[model samples]
Target: MAISCSFFLFMVFTMMDHHVGGHENVCEELRCGGKGPAIRFPFRLSHTRQPDHCSFPGFTLSCTDSNQTLLELPISVKLFVEEIDYISQVIQLSDPNHCFPIELRRLNLSSSPFQFLFHEQDYYPRGYGLFNCSQSTDQRNGIFRISCLSGPTHQVYALDLNDGQSLMELPISSCTKMYNIPYVPEMGDANILHLNWSTPDCRHCEQRGENCRILKNNNSTDESKTECFPRQRNHAKGRTSTKLEIVGAILGSFLLVLLVFAIYRVYRYDKVEKENQAKIEMFLEDYRNLKPSRYTYSDIRRITNEFADKLGQGAYGTVFKGKLSNEIYVAVKILNTSKGKGEEFLNEVGTMGTIHHVNVVRLVGFCADGFRRALVYEFLSNNSLDKFISSADVKNQFLGWDKLQDIAIGIAKGIEYLHQGCDQRILHFDIKPHNILLDQNFNPKISDFGLAKLCSKDQSAVSMTTARGTMGYIAPEVFSRNFGNVTYKVDVYSFGMLLLEMVGGRKNTEVTKENISQVYFPEWIYNCLEQKEDFRVFVEDDGDAHIAKKLAVVGLWCIQWHPLKRPSMKVAVQMLEGGDNLIMPPNPFATTATTRTNARIPAMDFRQELQVIPESE
Candidate 1:
């Protein structure tokens, strides 16, 4: 019994030393000068000086030879690091020459991890215009002059966005609009920029006067999560002799108790882990019954050439470009270990193994050797639909309006097949442009079945323990039953949003990085439908306009918030494959604000007035 206690004591001390060494080596705080702010975790000295684990991915700083600290943001100019308040997650930055108006004109922080410190209610910072006016111009309320940018007769000012003034409303008499500072909060000192991060959220911990650091876990590979504790950071230089002695005394006592508890916990944990491993093995054995050809882990390595050529990655796994034959290419998705124990692996394999549609991605093979799992799919050279869509961004318009119409039709047919052609009903809970892969010829193919749920054809609804889907595309019904039960219509709703994105140059709800005011894409299209306008997209001829109008109308019909007001995939396919005389869907957004359900629109819910789309909703 005495020997056991001593052995545990030895083990405990060794672990403590190891823990101290791990943090002490890489995350030591740095100083550019005696008065400079302490730089530590989430703000590394440099990649060459510190490991990535010691700091956040993009937050790297450099110390100048003259003892000045420089912090680079997305903008062209590098600002001097004035101070970093880890408590508030805010960083104070200043232009070297104190000419921020010139720097602010060129600054756009949307691409960077930082954002201007704005109130919670304010979704984002307001836009401001920069102008240089004559000294004789209308008297200004506040003077934020940019001396470097102004001449003897002119003074530069960044309009105070909080004052609710526009460029036209500005007293720009004898003033020239130099540039526009699209987004910034009103600061007391215009020369200083205060930017903050929402992540590495240490404010709560800091408010409690506890130190925040990466949450240490032996089991987890993810380092993104952080937690709070009493100061465990190892800055040997910062430690006082008395403080070190006190910490050592406390640890000497605390570690004895912790080690005893840890020994008992480990025994119990090992038993549970063994049981889990056995259960997983049983599940793998059952996977042998699946229809797709089973390949060993070795076969996967050979086929993928050890994952040499990379393709892309998504939520479930990383895809690598592979070659099965000299003539045939494949995309192999190696399932992420963090993805819950074999559930997503089983979901994709079981559903896709039985499917065969031109518009659906083909499952060439799969690998489930021991704990390793991978899925092989037919290679599509054109990549996912997301890259090809978004019109204004595409200079040449890779897929013309005619081709987009065809791709939309093909996607509709694929979804229609999933709903009706399959032996059992398969509801693909996720259907976004990213999941829609394009062939060499630009034919649409639906992929990624990890979120799909199976039900009997006769069943009216399937039970869901949790909502499963990409945000922005998830159906209203999935979030609230008040919208109705989860059904095939969920896919219809997502497809509607996808159609709208393709028609518009951007996402239906996407905001410009510069925060330019643009109407919502769906709302814009809805207004166009009501006004009998051509949607103002780049159009070559009347035929293109007709096709675009047809797609937009069908999309609006399919996205009626309530499942009861959404058309089935079968009806949607008809709408796409049909002629141009399709009547507009009833305004679905009218009653959204008042009541989601229980509000009737007098005989015009989901295509009752129109001959097509089948009043199924």
Candidate 2:
């Protein structure tokens, strides 16, 4: 009876092995046309291949009657597949209908796993051309009258004319069609657009002699991501690789179980064995070279006197007064454990550990004991610059225009040090009056490295996942990649906002008595400067007035909408130091800087909410 059962099972296994082998053989084979290039794996011939054999929905290739391979995209646009390079993972596609240029704007691949293949050598800058206008206006000096579609009644407005302005200001009032064409629109026949796409990303796996197979099925999309596994080696003629793999896997599992049992016994001997060996390696890697004194949870309590003297509180953490020695005073900030990824603690330690400057705040030590984390810093005598600034009142606490100018220069110098002085360029994403601490002599020092990012000095931009810094002080580029990538200029923009705040003696956002929101502080200040208004800053003499104007002009220059428009921190320092002769910058508040009149914010109450202590701890 046992012999008969074994024979029956052997027959079933043989049949299954044969079927799998046939499928593998078919998958490895390439499909080709009479004249077209051969395609395989990611690209499958829909007629010759089974639905389960294809990797993705959009990757299927169809052969035409004339032997041309056609690729129909998700957008219902069909293109002739000229070439496919599996090595580079690129598919060359050209519109079958040569008359109509592919609407590049509408060619979105957000849902697909492909990206536009843009090459610098073959790239061409394009501009919009408004054509077939019913009415022709007087702004038609460079507007060419297109006689192809219609007679002289149709005018084609090109961006090449009139200082490269947008189609938003098009003179043709009744334009029927607007299309974005190559800058040199005369070269009609040479208008082949190239796009590159990447997906399945299995080139490396193929290089390692591995086969890619779908692990999970996406029932809704009818496609799924592919995973790679090593190809099974054949053992003999009749005996299949599947049976050998199963027997070997069983033996390996038994050995693994025995090894794990031994390790468990050893681990039990030392109960405090590393919770996660991988996480320990990562922790060591992140803090390899950085030297900050790590403190225990008890040490934090001892330093803060059991949370006795509270200096200030914020959304993230609370600052407390801690004494290191008889003469040494340090500000201890205990972070809320449940809030963030604990990146703020890492940022302050890693960034501030390497720097030493008067204008920039100093980092003394840090504590990262389990979840209880705290940061210690040299406490300033005067808390922050926010207490000194108020639009409604500044009579007794007026620092005078000259003094304020000194403070601005000091702050600028600190930022310059952070940018130019450090081995790596450090960007203080949060740069506002609240973050700027003052000394007894009223010298401004930049504090709060929690939101700071460090990048190479030569690096043009720093990549960020989410926007950092206060909402009012955030640069436009930080919020949207359309503005530009986040760079050191982000700090410059924030500084510009801060400088304007200092000059205006008010928060940037305000709610009017009539419930209609007024212009932003920077806009209001820019208008005041443009019209040569007094700015209402307490100006005792000509020097004070000159100082205020200088601050305002530099402030305006720093807050230019585009990153390239704003000067570098080095140049900004020069401008701040170079007295009286600074040129008035152009209006930075272009059409993009729109006012939100409906936003009802209690500006004074908000400012008062974050008011750091005026006196030292």
Best by lDDT: 1
Minimum summed lDDT over a 10-residue window in model 1 is located at: 608-617
- lDDT of model 2, residue 414: 91
Flag regions of model 1 displaced more than 4 Å: 1-290, 508-520, 592-617
Q: Per-residue lDDT of 288-328 in model 1, one digit per residue for the tens?
A: 43366788999888988988998987777899988874447
Best by TM-score: 1
How many angstroms is residue 228 displaced in model 1 relative to the true structure, after the best TM-score fit? 97
What's the lDDT for residue 209 in model 1? Answer: 73
Worst 10 residues of 2 by lDDT: 601-610
Clashes by residue pair, model 2:
116-196, 117-195, 117-196
Q: Write the per-residue lDDT of candidate 2 for residues 283-349, one digit (tens) a residue.
A: 6665354456677878878888888999999977999998764456788999999778988888888
